[model samples]
Target: METCGSMSPYWVKLNASNCFIGIINNVDCPENTTGLESSTVNLQLTAFAFMITQIPFSVVFGLALQDTENTFLLLCGGCSILVFLLFPISGILAFAGCMLILRDYPDLERGWSFDLCLASSILILIEIIITLIVTTVMGIRSSKRKSNGKPEESVEGKGSSKDGDTQTQSNSYGHSIMKFAQVAITNGAEAAKNAIGMK
Candidate 1:
């Protein structure tokens, strides 16, 4: 065996090379020693995925309940409020759970964090899209009805036809207003024409 203090220059170089090769071999090993760590990371991602999936259902139900008529609206609103309120609370709980998992397993890939964040952002985007679509459809339907001359009636009998005397009085009033406006306009035009020396 070579003595440590008196080792040849060639032997020293070979020992250094061997130590470097061992590090490289360890890095290239097929069996990762961090299997438990990877599984923990995967579990966290799976949990986050479940939480994200619940968001859309909550948003849809909430909006649906909000758009419902009075009686149904109350029921739907209650359920929707429960869901909308609970989903975030649950999501925060899940995130806390994930953080605990991450604390236990610090070797997790950073990529999963970005992916979970992206999924949450996508859930918000989907809710906005759904809201826009429902509102747009309702607006179009309302405008179409209005353009079709469907006059919305009040609780009173305001839309009903009046008695003949009332009708005659209204017609006479409208005719008088129109005649007065026409006479005023004609007189104004005549005055302007006379001032301008026009026949």
Candidate 2:
């Protein structure tokens, strides 16, 4: 029998003399092997970590900014984080139960194990679908706002013009009117001086 870690749900035993290693999957293995076959495992692990670490940070940051435009998005992101957390947690528990059941009985089919592996895969697909729909809707709304001639100005003080020449002409007309007023004033002052000198 192998010593069990407090975090692990199951005990692990290795019989090196007989080249046998058995993991009694009672505890959750939050860390997965880093290899091609276990890529989903790694992804789920990373997502779980993000749920625990990044989600709260993101929520706090969003609250600090206090942006009404991003309120819905922040909430959705928070829900996604919750889903990520719950899915893996439930999966780990289910996997642990299944392992314990299989350990007691020696005649489990390979197909059942395959099904267990696919659970995480299905959850990942669901996450992807949800993200796609949310992002697509946001993108469409943004495009619509841009097309309505109310394009949001960038932080760097750059703006898009619906008609460049129209803006330029408007600016030019204001400048011309100011110049004409100044010239008129100067001419009137000169005429007054000439009249006084002649008098």
Candidate 3:
């Protein structure tokens, strides 16, 4: 009896197990006999790990969509890139493991297990492509929204500054008028005193 991680879908786990079993059953080489088990185990572990990592990413992406926060979006993008990097690594691991298992029997017929794995790999790649596109589009839209909002704020700021300038000018004019009135009163008192002295 073989055990699979609970995180992976049952069908995927079943198909992956079948593929490994198919490879191990057909090859008669001594090295394959010794190494095939470990390689297959590693392949399964890698697939499970990939699936496990996606769960949190899926949750984060969903939140990003609702909240539309750039921080969340950025995190999701980083995760997408990381996952994109992992695809090739996982592919290479799968290829190496399969090759190691089937090196002795090049002519062996790959049955349904191979077909399943191939189809799943292609679908996974397509999914990754779609995810990257969506994340980029979302990020672009978020930036556009921010840009659209900035001009309105700037306009309001300009209006407030103009009002402040008008108030400052009015205050300065009032002060000057008051000073001129005081000087005129002083001159009038002096002129009246001079006229009285002459009389």
Among the numbered candidates, top lDDT falls to 3
What range of 10 consecutive residues in model 3 has the weakest lDDT sum? 1-10
For model 2, residues 1-199, the per-residue Cα lDDT tens digits are 0012112322232222222112223222233422111333343344334435545665665664576688766766566555555544544533443344346434523222334333544455566678779999999999998866543454222533435667999899999999999999999999999999999
lDDT of 3 by residue, 52-161 (tens): 56667767667766665588677676676576466555544444444543554455444444444445545565666787899999999999999999899889989989
| Local distance difference test, candidate 2 | 0.47
Report the number of the highest-TM-score candidate: 3
- TM-score versus the correct structure, for each prediction: 0.30, 0.30, 0.45
lDDT by candidate, in order shown = 0.47, 0.47, 0.56
Worst 10-residue lDDT window for candidate 2 reads: 1-10
**lDDT of model 3, residue 87:** 58
Off by over 4 Å in 2: 1-109, 151-199
- Tens digits of lDDT, candidate 1, 58-146: 77565766673667666565665665544444334334434544475355333333334434534544666687799999999999987
Tell me the deviation in Å of residue 186 in model 3: 5.6
Q: Ten-residue segment with the worst summed lDDT in candidate 1?
A: 4-13
Instruction: Report how far residue 66 has shifted in candidate 2, in Å.
Output: 16
Error of 3 at 93 (Å): 7.6
